[model samples]
Target: MKKKITVKLDIQKIVRITGNHGGYETGECLLCEASGWLEGEFGSPYSTKDTGADLVHKKNCLMNKVLA
Candidate 1:
């Protein structure tokens, strides 16, 4: 019989890496007005990307702003 190898992963590390840390901070979500959110120009903000249908701006706006 062969033994199986199972590796356990940390959820906190995964969340931090995946950038899925949900919380109320500053500059986080432009829509929800969250903080610690990434900012960038994802999609065409001047085009149909801001039709309230496509929320590609949020994804594009991933700015890393740290507090002093």
Candidate 2:
């Protein structure tokens, strides 16, 4: 069996991330930012994560019912 991996978050990281892409117009999650989502970006594009299977991963997510 394989263990599940998760995205990590921190205060400084969040501040830096949000500061970089806080107003993308999308309600995607910031804390659980996924890497390589953007084309040639390699890093998460504006911290708008599409991986919302977990609770934290769903933070600020557009599909996240909690946000909706």
Mind giving the per-residue lDDT tens digits that candidate 2 earns over 1-68?
99998654433333222222443322223445532222221233334444532123334432233222
User: What ranges in model 2 sit over 4 Å off?
Assistant: 17-68
Report the C-alpha lDDT of model 1 over 1-68, residue by residue, as the tens digit.
Answer: 99998655432332221244364212223432323332232222222334443222333332111110
Clashes of 1: 15
As a TM-score, model 1 comes out at 0.22
For every candidate in turn, the CA RMSD to the true structure comes to 14.0, 11.3
TM-score of each: 0.22, 0.18
Global fold similarity of model 2 (TM-score): 0.18
Error of 1 at 25 (Å): 8.1
Candidate-wise lDDT, in order: 0.30, 0.33
